[model samples]
Target chain A: MHHLRTALLGVCLLSPLGAHAYSVYVSSEKDNSITVVDGETLEVRQVVPVGQRPRGIALSKDGESLYVCTSDEDHIEVLDLKSLKVDHTLPSGPDPELLALGPQGRFLYVANEDDNMVTVVDVDKRTKVIEIQVGVEPEGMGVSPDGKWLVNTSETTNMAHFIDLSTHEVVGNVLVDQRPRVAQFTPDSRQVWVSSEIGGTVSVIDVAKREKVHVITFAIPGMRKELIQPVGIRITDDGSRAFIALGPAARVAVVDTKTFEVEKYLLVGQRVWNLAFAPDQSRMFTTNGVSNDMSVVDMERLKVLKSIPVGRLPWGVVVGP
Target chain B: MNPAMSRSSDWIRILASLSLILSIGLVRAEPLSIPIGLISAERAEYIPLSSLEPRIEDEGLEGARQGILDNNTTGRFTGQSFDLLPVTLTSDQSPSDVVRDLIQRGVRLFLVDLPAADLLELADLPEAGDALLFNIGAMDDDLRTQGCRSNLLHTVPSRAMRADALAQYLAWKRWMRWFLVVGPLPEDRAFGAAIERAAKRFGAKIVVQKPWTFKAGASRTDSGHFNEQQLANSFTQVEDYDILLVADEADAFGAYLNYRTYRPRPIGGTQGLVATAWSGVTEQWGATQFQRRFLERTGRFMTPRDYAAWLAVRSIGEAATRTQTGEVSRLRQYLLGPDFKLAAFKGVPLSFRDWNGQMRQPILIVSPRILVSVSPQEGFLHQFSTLDTLGYDRPETECSIR
Candidate 1:
């Protein structure tokens, strides 16, 4: 009887339908909902109604809770991952757009775009810890891998401010291209990358020196310079390649991390805003804000395998098991 | 050593390290202040014709003030600060003397809000040799064409650009024939010339051209409103045309022709549907925040002059931040350099045309209520950039300034 049961389990694991093990959650800015997709199969499982103006999203460190920045409501909604429901609300400052998790998920750094401040929330206590004043129209938030520094990018100010985690104070600020929308820390925590939407350049900052070390520019055949706006940046966990979503250009540029050169531009959906990776890093998904769908790309072949309809004006995406 | 004494010594060591780190941080942050000058000739008090038009008190100065605040926000992070030195000269005061005094006071970047003639006088001053002058008020096409100055960059669109912007929209709408009405003013005649030039360039036919000689009615009272309709009706009776284009730079009888024109043709050019560099109706491309901030700051709407002045100051601020210096020559070179682009809440990054020193931007076509369209319209292409299609392209420019 044990041999027969083991053989049956092995057969089930080899089947195609059994490969859907991951889930992708996307925040829709217009529809005010979170669309959940079966990561592997590219199927929409549910469209969970969220707060007003759901934009930036991030999963908890343990992947058990999801936080959605409801910019219109001026609050962060904590959604229960297991039950797929709003567990509670955390206090965010005015007009929260994007957020990042501090070291060990101890603090949630939320960028209040209108107020020009970053609201640091104590995740476990569900309380507002502090608000650090930053530059004008702060949008992007990034925490170093070691959790020692938090970087906030302001659009109008055209700068990336580095806040010390221990002191919760800004220790340094690095200027970048115009209207930087997102900042990402490499997995190894040696460098920080920022994508400027209007400037059309990605600035790589040396973490220790706190200055721009390199600037990556993108060019696509037959595309105008104004349309090649670099918005979302995601460096793979292995630190070998970085994927950047060029907003309004409808393409993603895959850059080699070691060489700092653009290897290829993968055509995606229109006005892509953000991207997420499967837990195993074998697949990637991009939220197309204008097209109202998500493009699922196969990492191995560097091709968009399918696009699944999600919600209106999808802004951000995050994946979990 | 004794245990208690050793513990006290360790405390002192820790405190020493803390103070050392704090001192290093302080030494690293040396703030630099960049002083900018605002030069404008004092104007007579502007009185509106009616209550419908709100009197703008701080037209150009308020915009510069707001721009200073914006620059400082970024400057605080970059260890740089911007200071505005505004000097409004009286009619009797010499612009050369004022500019020399400013240079003595260590001011290099200037925002000049003066008429075309006064601007040329200021630009010709020897004391203004090292200063980078930004023209935010003058709209004369000659300043951008044959009379262009190397040191001056005009933020305000030239008359030709505005005329071309309107002409492109009309062409896109297939309104190929136009009836032109010129007002009774020298500036109005200049605008009329620009309109005719734009029509010729855009392949439009001016079926008939006439001058508006009707006396403007004082429509502030009930009796005045009674004769306004009749006066406007008689003023607009012209030959067959698709659109009635008016050149009323004086704003005398433009508003009255909106609903009172014969044949019910849509009015454009200086009234009704108009093309402007900036408008209060625009809310796209993250401009709502700017509008809200301006409203909160001044308790009034932003005018075109205010927007132009703001952009002038912002250009200086952006150049200063990028070059990391307040030196006038360096900032000027960076501005005219090919890599210079300023994101001024427009969909596209704005840059200066090297030939004419005019900032190339997409003009907004607005109705009274909402923004209708943005020009440099579809199918209007340039060899380099679509923005070049709006104004005098490189080949057509006659500017001799180097």
Candidate 2:
């Protein structure tokens, strides 16, 4: 069934409208390159080589440039969308693994896995604004939609630190679970979902109270409990649904926001690490590290469309016009 | 003259009382400091057979230090602080005296990296009655059974657990036949006995069992390779078997028997493929970042002993973080309670056994350079946890910790 849909999509891409289709950019950690895939055709467009170990990629708010975290080289490489070439480098403190752009897209919050600090860099100026000290081994970064807060999840400390934008200090902290890999705020900015990779649970924290409101656990029949590691999390723009990427389980759990219950599991590639949605929210793309491919999901149907081979150890993804 | 002098002294006493009251209020406003003591003894260093292996001066101490750093990171937000006070015993120093001094200093949590005898001596001290000791070095099975103490908890895996872990994997591979080779040392014999128990429990047969009595000479000399090769070949010539199960914990001849066995069988015991709590080759389940952090901090690969020491300190940190107290009684209750579970880079949460005070954890079946599998291998299940299958279960435990 998926192969037939992929074949139909390929046929549709041959139309004239597909020439102006949006592009999906994926960061490959092992290949140290950015794979450009045509959104309309679900085909590989280009494999632009970048710096060493690119894991996190973020699209600018203006949708003109892509910021790729070259973790091993301890810097962020800026790739111009037009030329698909390396433009410049931002000073990321040390071993930047994942990053999040602020709501206005002026400052980029980079999580330095080695130094346990979040480096906020000015994209326009190409300089570091400040380094906010956080817990040990910070990996995940998220910014509130209202531009009032930045949440960083430390893998070792197992806490989501709420950094006040005005003061640049950790105003509050919520202890979630072990080895939190992602901190994602809801569209309404009232709650944040933190994924614990080892604890195998997702904790929902109330933004106002800075306290955990609910804990979401997953249980799959005939599957070992340890393999249900929750990593990447994405909530729809309407805040009605959520998609959680279960690492090494090869499944993405579809959760309803209202009841906070899992509705279904969509099978994806192996070791799915992160995911991103298209501009219209009609489709989703996931980076599967072990399989070296990206699984495209038809969001409306809640089914996997196809898996497109990309590069070795694909870690992060972002869609751009 | 006497009246004036007495009036001045009365004013001084009142002023001192006022200052004491203000200082008490200030101290109460500060964060509570929890100091944990780490006691270990120096031993004669033995050179490893492989030059790639590093000779570390602070094997377990570095792990304890890393644990303290990790605890402090969490403590920053919790409004608590942790400190590690370590003492390395010399040739003439006694462990009991050190325990007494630490107890007097009001340290209630201790991580001891000593042999079973010295660990028991410190646990028996009257001054340590209110203190809790974590064994991070000893792996003797007796310490978990008949020699258990009420106040002592073991973070290190026992020999029986390691043996069972290996046996389960071997059984899964259907390697039923075995040629067992035991070393001459007492520790080797104890390990060999555990292997025997595991073979019986897991439904494997030992085809031929023999003791290795060869005395190895200087291994770095020009003629060392020839002599060692001949010794391993002659010692391993036995009846037909699937694999050679060796018990050489002292590292005397196990490494030499890797490819020198007469029957061309695989080695599975303490040498070629071993079961341990932790190894450098283990990098899954978020252990890669942990290995990187440890390497950047200590410039050495983490050993099993280091991991045990780290687990000991992290266990206390987990307890104190949950209970928010430095009091001995409260932390002890919290650690042993059902609410306690530690995330130590393993795939699952590790907890202590109520019957024996031994920790329940998954054993890593690793070769020297890669991880083969983790046991409590699939299909080996217990009524409670699958980890219970790797060690002494509750019904089989002889320990009665009150």
Candidate 3:
């Protein structure tokens, strides 16, 4: 809109120090590069060329560095958060698509899409400590609230494997609906919700017994569960609300955490992919892969307030300090 | 004394035989060494279907192994000896290791059963010059698309080629509208996307898409699972849809969507209207001899995969046979050239695309029960056979190495 014409010149002239202390990294799957954006300014600052196809991005908790798994490269690249230089590299299991970092960023759990295993990396040592076998084509991974259990979702097998964090062995498994993509536990850590992208439902399981107690399905007539394709679900820190990036339909669905009901759909950019919340959970950012842009959803207003242009096929987005 | 004399005679005969064997082996063992390189996945110790519920005719890797042996015997009978040098790749290993191992073994061709990227890695390698790759199981259309390589020859049809064959016959039936039910897997969607493309090209519209969810342990009692009553009451309302297109490539729940389809609709995508290579009825048009020979050799029915294996050997034989000049370079040139064609009984004479090395053939749309139709409808035409209409042609392909 050229609304920031004067402000842009001021920023270009270095009139004020950038307030964007935290950087947002968008892994562009199509273009095969990582676009670094200033979270506050929403300006695409730099593009870092990486491997063949970059899908997942995770920042170190202390904001010292970032890790990206380029699927085709078959390795994870470590980028210094301040210098934005690829400093260290570590071997990951093949075709890593999603990553779940342990609490305090000591260990990184990577879901290798092609291998059907989860690689546990000691980030400090820059080495893979152990790789635990999981279900077929593990697509999503999440650590428990207390970081006791690492849940990895296998898309084809339609199951969630619970790995004991200390032992790094698959302790248990819970069968869910078809194409389960993401695994997340509620704030209380009593329940684990696994989203089935194709099965068109989320299976909420009891963490203790590892049994599925509830299956959540949407009743949007004329839309097939396979096509509805839920991916990258984020529940609020308070655990009252959840936002799911629904594929093909190009919308972010808001769900009531307690009721497990889809409350509403927030129209986002095309192919609304992975999303991340602001530190306070006041806003949500999604990388719209098809439209090559980012959709900024105001969580308080429950609406997509703006769409910012990005690189080709913005896949995984990260919002953190 | 007579027994000792007899024993001494026996030793003389044995000694003479041993000398003869030693002298004969020296010449016979001279290095006319034939080398064959095999690229396969890690050896699997446990088999699910075979271990859990063994079938009279298996459907898993065991079946593939048996089919390979059947075709290998045929190759052996023709005097082409293959010593398998199998290199297994795990999720952690680098694929370039395969290229190096094959080179060390003096392997000129590779029977590749790896992912597309791994195949590409070998093709792109500078040291992998003059090496030919035969794709056994990569069904991704993109491998035939932008990733096509000159040195690679696909024995398996691209996913779209097989999917489109089924769609065309259904379209001919005036199945103007389809209720496209796709599976959740990305691979299925990729194949389904090709079907969707074919449907649009043939003037069929997907009116509604529904995904049936099958939970792992939530097996409904057959008391209500699929009976006449269940089928009739499966869907309360099916709107504007005449046929169902199921695209579950994993076969996870697709088999159920076929005849059990609610609302009296026909299944098209994965189940009812299927396009494939080398169906048993494909023998109807003089393929009877092929079916007989294959069946007799294996003592089992032929699968689509078995045909690909057969075609790979036959293509090489046909190329070698047709070339009167017995030069290895000339034979290789004939196969890699654009003009070479083989009568694989897949329908019209098939040839390699040269660009990505995928075979072009008329796909047979058939079911386990019967043959439905042939794709590249009678009137449709391409420079090659209408089968070229199934997958990417020269202009649209992104394969760079070719």
lDDT of 1 by residue, B152-197 (tens): 9989888888999999999999998999989998888888999999
* Listed models, DockQ each: 0.38, 0.30, 0.01
Candidates 1 and 3 compared: the better one by TM-score is 1
Of candidates 3 and 1, the better by DockQ: 1
**TM-score of every candidate relative to the true structure:** 0.89, 0.88, 0.49
Using lDDT as the yardstick, the better of models 2 and 3 is 2
- lDDT order, best first, reads 2, 1, 3
Q: Where does model 1 exceed 4 Å of error? A: A1-20, A48-51, A62-64, A80-87, B1-30, B48-53, B400-402
Error of 1 at B80 (Å): 2.4
Give the Cα-based TM-score of candidate 2 against the true structure.
0.88
